[model samples]
Structures are given as C-alpha cells and as structure tokens.
Target: MPRLIAPGSLRRIGTFFSDSGYTREALRDTLELSELPWRKLRNLHFLLHKTQEATALHQLARIFYLGQPADEALLRQCIPGAIFGLMQDAEMLEVKGGVAKPACMVAPLENLVLVSDQITNMEVELLPDLVLLPNPTTLTVSRFMLRKRGANVFDLGTGCGPLALLLAGSAKHVLGTDINPRAIEFARFNAALNGIENVDFEVGDALAPAEGRQFDLIVANPPFFVSAERQFVFCDSPLELDGFSRMLAREAPKYLLEGGFFQMMCEWVEVKGQRWQDRLDEWFTGNGCDVFVIKGFEFGAAKYAHERLFEANPLHPERDIEIFEQRLAYYRERNVTAVHGGLMAMRRKAGSNWVRIEDIPHPPKECFGDDVVARFAGQDLAAWATDEQLLDWKPALTSRVRLRQELTARDGGWQPTMQRIDLVEGLASSLALEPPVASVVCRLDGSRSVREQAAALAAEAGADAGVAQAEVLRLVRRLGSGGFLELPATG
Candidate 1:
C-alpha cells in the first residue's frame, strides 16, 4: 500500500517554505524520490510553481507513469507565472506517489490544498470513520448560489470546508456550521492554514445557530444517505432514510430571506406506492417556497448498500457472496428498490408557496440548476422569453404550447397535443390543429388586433376566414405559455 501523507507533515512542508533554500532542497529530494524520468522531472522542476505548469505536471506525471513521454517544451509552455518563483516556494509543489504535482498553497489566496497520500493517512487517524474530501459539485453549486444571492451565505455540514471556503470568496459574511467538533476544528484549521479569514466555522446542527439569522443564499450537502446500518460518522445521517430531507424541508425555510434560494444535493430512498416527486413535494409544506426537484441518478437498493458499506471497509473486498446476499435481502425487506440522488433548488416566495416536482428523468449533462438560479436572480421571465414569447402573446394563433405535454415522439412523430389559448383581450381561445402541419405562433401584437391578423391569415390561405380562425386561435394559446406570443396591453 502507498503511504498517505499526514496533515501534520503537510503543515510542516508549508512552514518549511519560510526558508528559500530549504524549499529548493525539498523539491530536489522529492523529485529524486519520485524517480520520474529525466525529461519529465526537468519539465516539472521548470514549471513546479506556475499554476498552469503545475497543471501540466499533473498531466505529464500521469502520462510518464504510463510509460509515455511528452514534449518538455510543450509542457513548459503550459506553466503560468515565473517558474523560478514557484520553484522557490515549496508550498506550491505537492508530491504524491513520488511524482511532484503542482498545487496552490498560498494561505490567504487559495486556502484549500489537496490532501496528498501523506495527509490522507493523518486525516484518517484523526477523524477515523469520517472521510474528508472535496465534493466539487457541492462546491460549484454553493459558489454559484453565493454569487447569485449576493448576501450572507450559510454552509451546513462544512465537512472539510470546501463549500464554505468557496462561498467566502463571494459572500459578505460566510458561516459554516457542522455538528461534529472534529469537523469544526478541521474547518477552522483549514481556514487558518489557507490564510482565509472571512469564513467562520462553529459546532452546531443545521438550523440551530441559524434560527434568528436569515440569509439570501443557503447551501447544504447534508448526509442524505439511507442505510440500514450506520458505521461512518460523515456518511450516515442520524435521521433514517429520508430523515435528512424531512429535516431540511421543515427547517431551511426559517433561515431563508424572502425570495432567497435554498440549493441542496441529497439522496432519497424510493418507496413503493409513492412517486419520488410526491414524497419530495410533501417536504415543502408550510414554507412559502417554489420547489424544483431534479432526480439525477438512481441506484438499486442492493447497489446502494454495497457502495456505502464498501466506502467504510474498502480494504476488505473479499467478503463472501452470502454476506452480500443477506444485505440485498435486507434492502428488499425495506421495500427500497433504489436510492435516488439529485439537486433540489427552492425559492421562498412572498406569496403562496407552490411546489413543482419535476421528475427531470434526464437532466442536462451540465448543471441546469444554474439556469434556475439565473432565472430566480433575474426575476424577469420576459428577459428569458425568446422564440416562445412571440408565439404566446399572439392571440390570432390556434396552437398553444402546453409545457406539461410531450409534443414529439422519440422517433419523430407528434404525440397527442392539448393546449388552452388566451386571446389578446383576456378571453380564452379554443382551437385544434390537424396533424402534419406547422403553424405560425406569436404573442398578441398590441399594434394590431387578433381580428385583423386572423383576416390576414385567412386571405393568405385563400379560404373562408372562419375555417382557419379557430385553428389559429388554438395555436396562439398553445404557444402562449411557451412565451411565443404576448398579450395585448389592457387599459
């Protein structure tokens, strides 16, 4: 097994960089120990401190270890900043498995450092059952929400403080709260080690300290794991299956400012007789917030148990089939077919709270929740109105767009379409279109009345105007919700 570096050792390395010559000597020794091929080592040493160069080193080391040699000049071209300065700062160079990987170690600038193997061992000894690592998705989401909300931010379950640290970059005041004292200590130590002063970590449950305080953006990566047996401190929520979700739904609303957004990534067990959406919808009760639930990935109960259990005891992979079988049976007995994990974005509304549960069977490859965040921040649905807007406002069109309906088949056939259209003057327009034709859809033009556009379309079609009038009205309403057309201004 490869030796993992302890956090203490990493701190020592960070401290050692106070001496310039000592930093260079340490890099030289690390390069020697890695036994990297000469060309690779040369390029790494040249780019050791440069951010871009450090990135290249990581790439080159992977390639070199695979026995493939890359051009040193090309590698050097990727280095950022003066190579000499970076080389002198030992804190910037991280050695793992004997190969030097470029990393940012400036405490005040970028506080988080990758826990190399040496540090991983130290963390394991300190926290034992609790694993601490960066969760990129949570970090990305929290950073985005912080920027969008532009006020105070709260990170529940700070873990290693990745999300809190990222939030601190943008939020006015960032507070990270954790239930575990060890995690709180680690978070504070990490902040101090990285020279980040804006973030504050305190030992407290999710909504406890946040009771009186309200925030514009709240982010949490709570332990939403649903397990029959709990072993690890970080992975298992004290609340059983869906308990975290229940708690969040009940508590988060109290801390959110009016129209503030609460974004979280969680796991929920899919129970029989309940649609996942319905189960999630119930959690949004009483909070005057619009909820958007996106189901990202689903794993069978057996796979969920195995994956989580393996996380705790990865060293013992030789467990027998019988043991695995019993675990699968346990999941079956609980009626848990699968565990669904995904992003949940909720906005507290000033008026009635309506929850929209979208199965989101297929979310975009990238985070679409960011789009929701943008929409919430902009608060102007009109700005997002493009093709869909013109069509919805036009009262003359017959086909209306219904977002709830599936219009086209996967193989390219139009499914049964149903829509309700509204006229420019606040009257509901009913029209249906026959298959095999596409019609012009637009919003009501205040400059022209629906009657006039209908007359023009009738003349263009060269038919009795009444025949196509109803069809046009139907199309207009269908496109209305889709923002295809605009309604005429009312006095």
Candidate 2:
C-alpha cells in the first residue's frame, strides 16, 4: 500500500522541488542530463563526471532520478526542515544507516512535475502493481490528442493520473479511472501533489466508472499491450492478445457525446491471412464515429517478443531468452505475423462514418492538436460534400504551407525539374505536385469561390468548364483531407 500525503504536505513538497531548481530546464541546461543515456546506473556516473559540487538540485536528482542513496545529513542541509519532516512522515523517504533513498521518483514533465513509484530495475524483481511515470508513448499521445476546452473529459486506465491532471487544466471537470487500487492511490496522491482540484480518480475496471456519462473529450493510455500474461498492471491486460484495445474501440463510443472525440494510445496484432487495417476497422464498422489510425511502427513476431521481453533489463540478454521463447511460442500458436503500434482517434457523429488508416512512418515532433481538429473537419467536408457543393465553398491554404522546387542547370539558366508542397506543421507531410495541380493550388486565395477559379482555369487552357471543375474538386478534397487547405464552415 502507498502512504497518502496530506494536502498541505503535498503543496509544501511541490514548492520545495520548484524552489530548489529541480526542473526540466535546470536538468537539461545546467546539469546537461539530456546528453546522457536514460539507464539508471549510467545516469549516476554521468552526473558524477559532470558536476563535483553536490547542490540541492544534484542531491534531488541523485535520490529520485539516478536511484542513489544520499547522506541524511547532506539532505538535511539542503531541504527545508518542515518539508523534510513532511516527506519523512509521508514515507517518501527511507532513511537508515545515515543514508536516505527516495521511496518514489519525481521528474519534471513539460511544465509540471509528477511523482510515481520508483521505476523497475531489470535485475530487481518486478512488482505486479507498479505505477509508471510519463514514458515515450505518454508523451506521444499527449502531443497528438485534441486539447480543445470542454465541459467534461475522461481518462481511462489513468495509471498515475498524469493525463487526467493535464486535461484538468482545460476542462471544467475531469475523471480518471483505473482497476488497480494501488495505482488509484498514487493518482490521488499525485493530484494533490500537483495542486489540481478539478480532477477525480476512481478505482474501476476499464470504462465502468465513466459509463453512462457523456464527455466532450476522452483520452486513454490503457494497458493495450498484446502479451501472454497479466504480468504488469501498467502495461499488460487480462484479456487475450489485442482484445482489450478492440473492446475499448467498440465500447468507448457509447460514452461519448455527439461530436465528442476519443483518442487512445494502443497496439494491435497483425494476424496471418488478414489485412491489419481491415481487421481493426471491423471494430467500428457501424459505430457512429469517424476513425483515424496513425500508425507508428510494425514489428515481426520474433522482434516484437525480444523488444518487449527485454524492455526492463536490456543490459542482460542472457536472462531474457527463456521468457522470450515462451512469448514467441504463444504468438506462433495464435498465428500472429506482426505487431503494430500507434494512436487511434475517433469522433462521434450521427451518420455514415469513414475510417482512415494512415502510416506516419516517424513519430511527431510537436503537438498537433489543432491539426487533428482541422483534419477531422476536412475529412467531414470531403466525404459528404458533392462536386457542386464543393465548388460553392471557398477554401484557402494555411499559412504553414510552403512550396519547394528542384532546379537543374539546363542549356542556359536553371530550369525547374521537380516541385513539391510541404505542410510544415502537424505530420510534416510533403507531396509532389504536377504543373497543372500546382497552378490550381496557387489560385486558392479564399477570396474567389472554387467555381470562379475553375472557370478561369478552363478559359486559360480552352478546356471544358465541367471537366475543369471536376479536376478542381479532386484537388480540394485531397488537400483538405491532408489539412493543407482550410474549408468554409459546414452546418
């Protein structure tokens, strides 16, 4: 069981960490911690080699991040007496033999600091209900999900509740749910530690706690790993391979308000004799939400097992061989060919729905929340609007759009050989355009309607107006779907 900290003590601890410069900026800039690898043992040596003096920030990093014990007298000299007492009383520090070690880890995430149970070391025994801090997937989902303000928001499988706390800043009310009681305790403790009061954490299975309640936005970082056993509460699920993610896709839509959004960080298996997209899209066949699956990477069965089995202790490959073989056998029995990982986003609507599966190839570098909203609106326009309706609508390119050309030396001056337009934001998509398509795009200034532009281009080329209009509509739909062009408002 985790010890609960009083609200007052939590506030004091937060103040102490902030005032001591235990921040992302100081860690990255002053300590140069970003230059080192993330392993625990390596980080300790790196810090020792980088700085000789043990400042308050150094002491905090050693205890919390590097997983090293610090002298009790040294900690007393740096931390405030009252706050130190609060930390000891709350069981955040384990002191013995004149040395103190952190019972939990506190690290800066973006602008906020979060606390979670100490990360699992590969050589150490794994705990069943270990709470995890923000990882790469958490950061990816946080950057990709929609961040629009709403009256209510829901976070499923909230773990230590970082996502729920982030949503609280923009939402009127936020609720986070998890199945592990230990995780819920940590979530509640973190909520108090961060001084965020608008969020609530509950212990419940899957989406049970938020059932029958409509939300403006729903985000989940659930235990969607396709593993053989329920080894870890933070990553593994009780359901068989990939069933948990499929279950969430089918059930979560019922809890969303009309026009609400649901985004989840997930992984799905690509079985033999089946298209992965077709298999996953079947989950939302008649469901009332337009779905988008942004693929990250795919791994074969053997590589997938090795990656996941060695996740905790990558340094000891010899120890993981037995476990890896067992997991690989499990996959072989199920005909699993490959495993895919990515983000799945859905928007609730009341008509025929469309599902788009796009491969991103690389992870996103920055937040694309606004780009997601734009793509949703753009797809809606493309799917429902007729050719005539599209011509009447005025669409304009976003300011982030830039055109690039490749020039080669010809007989005289440089001549353009290849041309492409790039959308610098969101997914950073770059598409090659033909000369005719390039000419069509340049005319989109939002001042002239599509019909007028199509007629003018037809007159310039002596082509049939109807044929030109058809070509223009195709270009608009393609660009709009990619979030390159902004379309007029739809009713």
1-491, model 1: which lDDT tens digit per residue?
A: 11223445435433333322222223234433233224313654443332222344333333222123334445444443354233325333444444444432221112343221122232124333353545445543443343543468888887767777766766777889888766676566566444567788898977897988998878888877775556555666668777876788768977898877788878887787777666676687776777655556788877777776644443444563545676677667877788888777777777665453434444443333344543333222332334334334334332333223236565677766653332322112223434312433333434554455556667767767776566555544444432334333210
- Evaluate residue 421 in candidate 2 and report its C-alpha lDDT on the 0 to 100 scale: 88
TM-score for all models, in order of appearance = 0.60, 0.93
The per-prediction tally of clashing pairs is 57, 0
Which segments of candidate 2 are over 4 A away from where they belong? 35-43, 312-316, 407-418, 487-491
176: Cα error in model 1, Å: 0.5
Candidate 2 per-residue lDDT, tens place, 327-418, comes to: 88899999999999888889998989998777787756678777777777788877888887888888888887899999999999998889
The 0-to-1 C-alpha lDDT of every candidate, in the order given, reads 0.53, 0.80
Model 1, residue 366: displacement in angstroms? 6.4
